[model samples]
Target chain A: MTATTDTTRDRIDDALVRLTPAQVTIAVLTIAALGFVLLFAQEPMVHDSLHTFRHAAGITCH
Target chain B: MTLTDHLVRGLKAGAVAGGAYGLFVALIGNPLIRYAETFEHSHSGGGPVVPRAVTALISTAGGVFLGILFGVVVIGALYYFLEPAIPGTDGTKSYLLGAAGFVTVSGAPWLAIPPQPPGVEQALGVETRILWYLLMATVGAFACGLSGYVYTRLRPRYGQAPAGLGAGLVFLSIPVVATIAPANPVSGSLPAELAFVIQAVTGLGQVGLWFVLASAHAWLLRRDRDEERTGYGRVDHRDPTEPLGVDP
Candidate 1:
């Protein structure tokens, strides 16, 4: 019984630390969005719009 | 609850934090920027192409959007990956992650070249400065990650307090190491006091952004636990159909 309990606890701990497939999907999507925004920020229009913020954010900006 | 659920919760917290930061930028950041612009324009011998009010409005909106993005990426995505590895309770992890984000994004770079106000002249080109900034950010992240790794290793033997102290010493060495990088030479018509104020405000805004992000994330996670405890929303963590000790 003690052995079984230990195994159960170990299984539960492994599950807690492991990422689900759904999580991997969300992380990929989030990172993609971040990349898109950074790339888009280089556009003159978008850059100008966020100029003040870029400075406020301590980003390297004109 | 699944890690995905935690990710969603992080998103919600980020939205709240971002909105709060946006409001802060609109209120405190806009006026100082306008004042600084006058100095820049005076030097260039041309007026602002866009009206001050319009620029302020757009930038305020942008700030909010960026804050949300910060939340989604740092609080949501990164947090999801680092949750298991980070020390402390959920809230403490959130706070540490937020601190790490600030250190990586702003603190490290600022040490090399402090953020400039409008009209300041940089010795280096934008691209070069950006490259340097990215490098500094990488260094800062390495420092934080190494500190965390060291803490994990030491915690088993030394316990929490001593491990944290050791980790902190590792983190503290980053600034000293950062001095090895060349500094950005700056020249500007903007007054010393005004420039200092601008930098201060910018730094404060970032602090507020991360502070809110961490606090809200912690709160949201705490609420999730509270709900689970009260049986308002219980999640069965066990996969009953999967036999114990069997790999999925």
Candidate 2:
């Protein structure tokens, strides 16, 4: 058997092997969504989208 | 297994746990909310409020969503990331982790600022209240998580019961100290007894939710163990058909 050198394709393949595409997608999406929430969640502010959640979850916003 | 696989499983666990939580809220919490609202009205004198039906629907829906999200993000994603560093299996201590979560997210914050009945005025400003809530919760979570590590380290030296006792004290101390923070202004409107009922019901509900979440996640992990190994070994890793599974 002859020895072969690793190619660019092999390196890219190895690099992609670390994380699944789904992981990347989910991570990015979660980060973006959280960023949006953190950026805009203010009082008398954007919208009380989670008003029901706040009360329902036993969080005091009254 | 890949972190993604863990997250997928976690989401399934979250949904099931979240459903159980929603069921609990619907079964018990809905009625309490109605009674609390009525009490608030009787005490404070308010105009017409939303119908009981609407309140129940909203509450149940909201609870389910919240449970799922917490299961996914906190239990699933965060747990996965932290697992690499945590020694042994990820969920070796489910009950303990769940208890820690409860103390961190709700119990500690509740101490800092107890839930207010409707038609009440808050002593602290809105922003300040939110700031304190987040700060206390975050600090409490860290303290609780640290205690677990401390317990593990001490277990060999001191033995289980003693180590757990020490760690438990360390865990309790953070919230006890945090109790010094100014409390929300209470409106004398609602009866103390009724407020107590509300607190007790909601507190129990949160505990139930966390319990269900932990158990559900553990079950899912056990059920999906094989899939995780195979799924991790795969390349490209984008399986649209990949299931976020929960057992029957």
Estimate, for each residue in B46-144, the C-alpha lDDT of model 1 and write its tens digit: 444566667677778777776677787788756755776778877799999999989988898788768888889888877777777888888899998
Output the lDDT of residue B162, model 1.
96
* DockQ of all predictions against the true structure, Cα-based: 0.30, 0.14
lDDT tens digits, residue span B1-248, model 2? 44566678778878988898878778776666556666554422343355455656755776787677778776776665554333336456455556767888788887787766454556787678777788788878888767777777888899989887877787677767677787666665667887777777778878888888888877777666654556654355455688755422
Candidate 1: lDDT of B100? 93
* Candidate 2 TM-score, C-alpha based: 0.74
Q: Would you give me the overall lDDT of model 1?
A: 0.76
Candidate 1 lDDT, tens digit per residue, A1-62? 11121232443454455757797588688777764454234555556566676777667775
True contacts kept of 1: 0.44
Docking class of 2: incorrect
Per-prediction fnat: 0.44, 0.15
